[model samples]
Target: METNLSATTAAEANPGTARDAAARHGALGTLALMIAHCAGMVDVVALPVWVGTLIGAYRLDPQQAGLLPTLFLAGAVVSSLFFSPRLNRLPSRVAATLGFCVAALVFFGLASTGRYPVMAALHAVAGIAAGCGLSFTHGTFGRSRNPHRLFAIAGLTLGFFAIAFLGITPGVIAVQGGQTLFRIFAGVMGVAAITSALAFPSLRPKRVAATPAEPRFDRAVWFGMAGVACMGLTQAMMFSFVQRIGLDRGFGFSAVTATLIALGFVNLFPAPIAGLLELRIPGRRVVLAGPLVQAALALVIAQSAAFAPYAAASSVLVAVMIFTHTFAFGMLARLDGTGRAVAATPAMLMTGAAIGPVLGGTLVKQYGYGSLGIAAALIAAMAVFCFSRLERRPN
Candidate 1:
């Protein structure tokens, strides 16, 4: 009778314990999402600095310098594509923990070397590892009760991260050179590794059926992915040379860096604003307008020799993408019940980004900075067409 009572008591307590554990996971999961986003998307802030450092500090030519970041993004594209479909079968926490840990190690290796070949190899390795962690983080977000809000909050976190990174890194690199940038990358990855290992939530994958089966994507998801990819290409192509363009046009380093700082400040509002507008505006319309606005900004930034016009355009270039992508992400999350499309965020964002730097470098090298504007216009048209093709669903 005593043993029976004890067993009954333990069973009674288990439900409450489970609920408490779930609440804890929810809170920690939000934090993990933010940190993972910052570490994974650090490229947005770091691209100009990273490429500039290679060219200015390490004496690499423009094409060669651009190649390094291209390689990094290419690896990310590959890794995200590979892991997204398999997310349901994999242990999310284990994959995220090990992926970030490996990335941290590779970034540390990067900080110790200046050799182009060696650095290139390390960048590729780091990208692949980090991409794996990022895919799991996004997939977890999709499994949440409110993926749009959670993703927007994650974007807001990235905005603050940008402010700190842009404000501090350029000055540090100015005094300490390129290695400081890699050291910072390693530290960021290390924090992500620890965070993932400790608190990344283990949400069950989205169900496509009652029985065990693979989820299939519809044509709408493919079109959405392609649209996002085009925007990614335009963003990366212009951002990779932003600092260089300013310098080449006789803008002082201080002025260019100031514009970058201003850009960070501008980034803070877009995600929250997007979140607020989610219920009011149609995502399809927002996406349709995004590409055109992005193209106009690219033109002014690339063509203007005047600091005022250049700074104004450059400051908001990234904001347009952030705002638009927030909506795109929300739309895709709803469209794909299986969660795999959203999990492939890294691949969608980085596929064209992988081609961007190298392509932009070639254009700038051959035809000068103005060529980027023309390229952006062309890509924008393609992006607009792709977004227009997406089947409208009830927001």
Candidate 2:
């Protein structure tokens, strides 16, 4: 009778324990998400310009310079597969905090390093950290209440952070050198990582209710992948050549920097607007249509005769791309309903993103900046084709 009573007591306590675990998970997830967004902005705005300048200083060819971005994406790809399963099994806060700590160290190393190879290696390490952090946060968010809303908020934050960081950091460093800029960014991320580690316990992990099994090869997944690829391609073209494109069109170096800053600023507003639209329209349509608009804008950019027209077209294209990509991510999580699946989506997206700059660089080497825009437009069109095929099938 005593043993039976003990067994019953233990069984009764399990539910409460599970709920407590869920609450802890959610808190870690939110904290992780914020850190990831901040880190992402810092990287997108600063890393590319820094790496590109480093490669140019070393007199490396376009292909050689392209390796930095490729390696970064490669790190992300490898880590995404490895990170998610491990994180899923660990305590969420512990996993997130550790990942951020690793990222902070890598950024500090990059800031201190002088050898090109070491810089590249540091970028790869940072990529791994980002991959792990993003996978954990995205996976956790997917299981939360109204995950789409949470994701949209995260996206908007990411955009604003990128605009703020990239807009100011690059120009500041443009007048200085890479080392100072990287150090500043390192300090910022270090503080963020530490704070995140401390504050991770307040939010709650969501208890995942059992749901129907998702299809293994859903059309929605493919569409989401295509949309992500298109967004990646657009970004690759813009970031890789925006400065050069401006200079070639007769803009001064200051004007080039200003143009980049303007693009970042433009990115800030569209994310919220896109998030709102995602709530009203089918995500498929938004994903499919965004690239088409971008393609049109790319064509205009390619054909523009003056700096004003080029900048105008470029800004519009960027704004549309950001909105579309943000919506695609939200839709991807909604469609897959699994952290692994959502994490896997970025792998496909990053593959395209990684390849895009290399392809754009090669096109520029062969033809020119005009060819780069044309190539991007063609890729965008291809994304539309893939999206259309997915749309014909029922959701």
Question: Highest TM-score among the candidates is held by which one?
Answer: 1
Please report, in order, the local distance difference test score of every candidate based on alpha carbons.
0.84, 0.61
Clash counts for all predictions: 0, 8
lDDT of 1 by residue, 66-141 (tens): 8999988988999999998876557777788888889889998998888889999998999999899989888766
lDDT value, residue 62 of candidate 2: 67
Summarize candidate 2's per-residue lDDT along 1-395 as a digit string, tens digits. 00000112221233222211332235443554666656643544554465456554445666666666666666766777686544334455555566667877887777676777887888788777766665656555554445556666766676676667656776666666666655765666665567556654322223224322223647756766765776676666656666556666777776766766677677777777866776577767876787778777766676666888777776655578667766666666556544445555446556676676667667777776677667767787788876666543221
lDDT over C-alpha atoms for residue 121 of model 2? 88
- TM-score for each model: 0.92, 0.81
The parts of candidate 2 lying over 4 Å away from their true place are 1-32, 41-43, 55-59, 85-87, 201-219, 302-305, 389-395
Clashing pairs in 1: none
Candidate 1 TM-score, C-alpha based: 0.92
Query: Ten residues in a row with the worst lDDT in model 2?
Result: 1-10
lDDT of 2: 0.61
